[model samples]
Target: MKQVLTIAGSDSGGGAGIQADIKTFQELDVFGTSVITAVTAQNTRGVIDVAPVPIENIEKQLQAVGDDFDIAAVKTGMLFDAVTIRTVADSIKHYNWQRLVVDPVMIAKGGASLLKEEAKDSLIKHLLPLATLVTPNIPEAEALSGIQIYNEQTRRMAAEQILKSGAQGVLIKGGHGADPDFTEDFYLDQHGGSLVLRSSRIQTKHTHGTGCTFSAALAAEFAKGKSIEEAFLTAKQFIQSAIEHSLNIGAGHGPTNHSAYRHYAQKEMIRYVH
Candidate 1:
């Protein structure tokens, strides 16, 4: 079986971060491994507290995973500060690992800051260059590119600037946009080609871990030997189904159902055959 690694924080709620990543990996039929950089005391409602792991321990975990598993792809979720970002970059370089997916998780669903303001520069400088694909939401894209994303023109401009940061590609997620009907995610490939993935908006509040799950599914598909475009499409479909069949476990924002994608695909196949 193929293996993938998630270097991110642990979400105690099992709705986002490492928990969501692992769940998505499992549902996608990949061996899931992780290096927890921090632990959040959070649930559906909000993040009560966060404790960042020590740099030394984080390095040790990465080295351990590298030594044991042949990680086919890797994804990052929340590196709390600049030091952790630098350490993670150095570790990835040392491991000589490619197929890196960087999910620039800056804020939580409850408006809590996951990435420190000071560490944004470190992420762009130390990590973006190493990323095979950097997945950023609108606000994140705006912050990374130092521009406002209002429409297609500005969104494309932000994507271009982010690619100039040395990332091979960028996916600007349109979840935060003002689209009333469809959520459009824009993808800019390394060769300057672009693809737009559109899915009808699901009116629900159970989108706590959408970003983490999308990047995780993307990495899992890559580990399974799918092409970048193929993996991106599968990831989009996965997230869409997961959102449409969201779970209702928490009082606040719940999590998307990771297993819903496989079921949805099976049903679609059956419908197609009939």
Candidate 2:
């Protein structure tokens, strides 16, 4: 089986962060490993408090993972501070891990800051250059690229700027935009090739872990030897199914059902194979 790593925060909520990533990896049939950067006192409601793991321990976790497993791909989410970001970058370089997916997780659905303000520059400087693909939402893209993404032209501009920052590719998620009909995610690869994936918007409050799930699904697909475009489409479909079958549990933004895609895929296969 393929192995994948998630270097991210631990969401006590089990709705996002490492919890969500692991669930995603497991459902996608990849061996999942994790290195917790921060522990957030959170639930479906909001992030109450965050305690960042020490840099030394963070390095040790990376060392342990790199020493044993052959990680096929890795995704990063919620690196709390500049120190954490730098440490993760150094560890990735040390391992020489190339299939890196950088999910620039900035804010939670409840409006809590996951990435520190001071850490943004460090992420851009240290991590972005090493990323195989950087997945940023509209706000994150605006912050990283200094381009306000009001429409397609500006989204393209923001993605181009992020690509120039050193990542081989940029996927700007358009979920936060004012578009009421479709949730369109824009993609731009290193060679300037672009693709836009459009999906019908699911109106619901349970869109909490959608980003994490999407990136994790993409990593899982990549580990299974899918092309970037193929992985992108698979991940897009996964998120759509997950959202459609969202778990209506928590008070605030709940979680997307990770197993929803598994069931959907099985049904799809059965229908086609029959």
Candidate 3:
């Protein structure tokens, strides 16, 4: 069985962060492992508190994983400060791991930030260049590029800037800025080619952990030996299905049902097949 690692913060709510990454890995048939950088008290409403795990402990956890498994791929979620980001980046560099997926987890669904302003520079300057793919939502793309991405044109520009910053690839997600009727995601390859993926907007509040889930699935598919384009396509489909079947439970924004697509969508299949 292939193994995938997620270096991130733990979400106490069990809906996003490390918890969501694990669920995504499991759903995609990959063994999930983690090195936690912080712990957050969070729920649908918002994050109540966040405690950055000591940098030394974070480093030790990462090292422990490296020693045990020939880690297939790695996807990172939240590194709260400069110290943790620097530490994780160096550890990843030390291992020279393959297929690194960096989810620029800047803020939570409810606008609670999971990363420090100071750490942002280090993440872009150090970690991103080493990644096989960098996944960022609109705001995250803007933060990294230092430009406000207000529409499709600016979104492309942001993706280009991030790519120029040394990342091998970039996925500028459109969940935050898409038209109410459509959702689009962009991917830029190392060879200077790019692809755009669009989905019909699902009206719901269960959008938590979407960034973590998408990036993790992307890494999982790559770990299982799929091509970057093939992996990106499969991961995008999985995430869209997950979002469409989200549970309408939480008061604010709920979580997607991770097991949603296990069984086929018979009705839709029939509708399309016929």
- Which residue segments of model 2 deviate by more than 4 Å? 265-274
lDDT of 3 by residue, 1-274 (tens): 8999999999887888899899989988999999999999988899999999988799889999999988899999998998888888898989888899999898888778788888898998889988999999888999999889887678777888898878899988889874998777887776768787777788888888788888988999999999877787777787788888877868988877777757546112101100
Q: Against the true structure, what is each candidate's TM-score?
A: 0.96, 0.95, 0.94
Give model 1's TM-score versus the native structure: 0.96
Using TM-score as the measure, what is the rank order of every candidate, best first?
Answer: 1, 2, 3
lDDT of 1 at 132: 91
Alpha-carbon lDDT of model 2 = 0.88
- Model 2 over residues 8-112: C-alpha lDDT tens digits? 999888988999899999988999999999999988888899999988999999999999999999999989899989999999998988689999999988888
Q: Which residue runs does candidate 3 get wrong by more than 4 Å? A: 266-274
Please give the RMSD of candidate 1 to the true structure: 3.6
Candidate 1, poorest ten consecutive residues by summed lDDT = 265-274
Write down the TM-score for model 3.
0.94
Per-residue lDDT of candidate 1, residues 71-179 (tens digit) = 9999999999999999999989999888999999999999999999999999999999999999999999999999999999999999999999899999999899998
lDDT of 1 at 133: 95
